[model samples]
Target: MRIKAAVLHASPIAKPYAETRPLRIETIELDPPGADEVLVKIAAAGLCHSDLSVINGDRPRQIPMVLGHEASAVVVETGAGVTDLVPGDHVVMSFLPTCGHCLPCAEGRAQLCAPGAAANGAGLLLSGAQRLHCDDGTDAYHHCGVSAFAEYAVISRRSMVKIDRDFPLVEAALFGCAVMTGVGTIVNTCGVRPGQSVAVVGLGGVGLSSVLGAVAAGAERVIALDLSRAKLDLALSLGATDAFLASDPDVVEAVRAATSGGVDHAVEMAGSAPAFELAYKITRRGGTTATAGLANPNARISLAPVHLVGEERVIRGSYMGSCVPARDIPRYIALNQRGRLPVEKLLSGTGPLDEINAAFDLLDQGKVVRHVITF
Candidate 1:
């Protein structure tokens, strides 16, 4: 089918030490799915930070790629052996999918399935081929295997998770990545218990979702921190027990005081070294500090072994919220339906597909919690 998509191809090579910008928004064609794949009519796609990472060169991706990963759509066609989904079913696209038999999947760590690495890199099916193309017959690879930036996408059955028909597809799209990562960090990784004290740095879409997740897990106090008061306000609306500006020198002290010496859990979602440092320093002895953000390649964090060893504090990284989409996406939707996860408040902007670049601008300025492209 002919589809209008934002295609990024290689530009004239940059000088040895300089950066090269990828070609943007060349319309392309998308082929129907092959066996074990499904063609989707995308209704809405969320502009995730990961997408911005590729556009700005933070994430090195292949050329001639369609850059979008967080998305929700209606199944338009199902390929052979795809029995559970059919036309009209609403679904969310997961950038990471498990083959069930892979080492990670068989070990209950589907998030790290071996195929996931290749899927994220080439955005292709397990067979190592793309289904998108240019009118001139040049193949356009998928970005993260589910390039929802286009009006239509062909994805693997393993990557598509069916959601309630009545769920808001646009909001559900956010769960495909941001919410999954944020909420899953607490619920799955930390197993936060009632009355536990928690602090989340970065109040963006993921941070706020962490706040909501902490609250849902019955944390007695959920502290939200960020440089933007706007985001802090939104965090409060989403159930943050307190909010603080990252610029405040006393931020860590204040958080420590609030949690009575230190918080039970500290989460950093800002992808900044300083934020990770703050998260680590504010956790009490034996407390857990989780890094859910995708940090830059050059970014680094330092720690004193003596202090780290003495404290017994656990510091770890979480990828894609440690989620298995087929199991977690629907559970998130159920939480939203039950009014436990207020996803609607996280949405700050929505517009047409043509405004794709504008959406990226808003994300760069930190002006929106989440932006969606609606058909």
Candidate 2:
């Protein structure tokens, strides 16, 4: 099938600037799914920072790749042996898949499945061959194992989670990544309980979702920190108990003051070294600091050993919110359906695939939460 997609032909090899090389939308051909695969007609794709990381060379990936990972769609075709999902089913594409027999999956940690990484990262099907190509017959690499930037994508059946048909695909797409990562950090990693005090650094899409997650988990004080006043306002509306502008040098002190001493849980979503430092410092003794951001390769964070030894604080790294998509994506959808997860406000923009560059611009400027590419 012929589909429209944004293809990244070369790695940025430098910081991504809008005036420089940007993802280009072109017509491409998608091969039919092989056995154990499924072809999906993408309804909405969420632009994630990780995709931008690949473009900027922060996350080194093969060139000429289709750069999108978070998406929701309907099943169009299913290859042999796929009986659980059939055509016409709405689904969310998961970057990680559980092979069931893999050590991680069998251990109930599907988020770290090994085969899922090998299949998706190699840009090959489970059978070891490409599934997308340029109209002129050049190869197209798949990003994050599931490139959902195109109108249609062929992915492994293990990489999709069936969702309620009535759920809005646009909002559901965010759950595939942003929401999952943000909320997962709170529930899965931090295990935040009722009346717990939390601080979420960076009020972007991921940070805001963290705030909502903290509130849903019944946190009494959800403090949000960011330089953008606009995002802080949005954070407040989404359930943040208070917002702090990090531009002020006294931001950490202010957060400490708000939480009485220091927050019980601090989540770093800014992906900046400084933010990680602040997350670590702003937690009370015995508190937990969770780093959920995808930082650049050269970024380094430093902390005093005296503080670590004295505070006895726990610092952890979260990947995809430690989520098992098959189990978590559906629960997130239910959260949205029950009015617990406010997702509509998180959507900042929607346009055709050609507007991808513009969407990235908005993201870089911190002007929008998430931009959806509609094919």
- Number of the top TM-score candidate: 2
Instruction: List candidate 2 segments past 4 Å from native.
Output: 13-21, 125-127
Please provide, for model 1 over 237-291, each residue's C-alpha lDDT reduced to its tens digit, 9 standing for 90 to 100.
Answer: 8888888888998988888887788889999999889999998888888899998
Ten-residue region with minimum lDDT total, candidate 2? 13-22
lDDT of the candidates, in the order given: 0.84, 0.86
For model 1, name the residue pairs that clash: 181-321
How well does model 2 score by local distance difference test? 0.86
> What lDDT is reached at residue 310 by model 1?
88
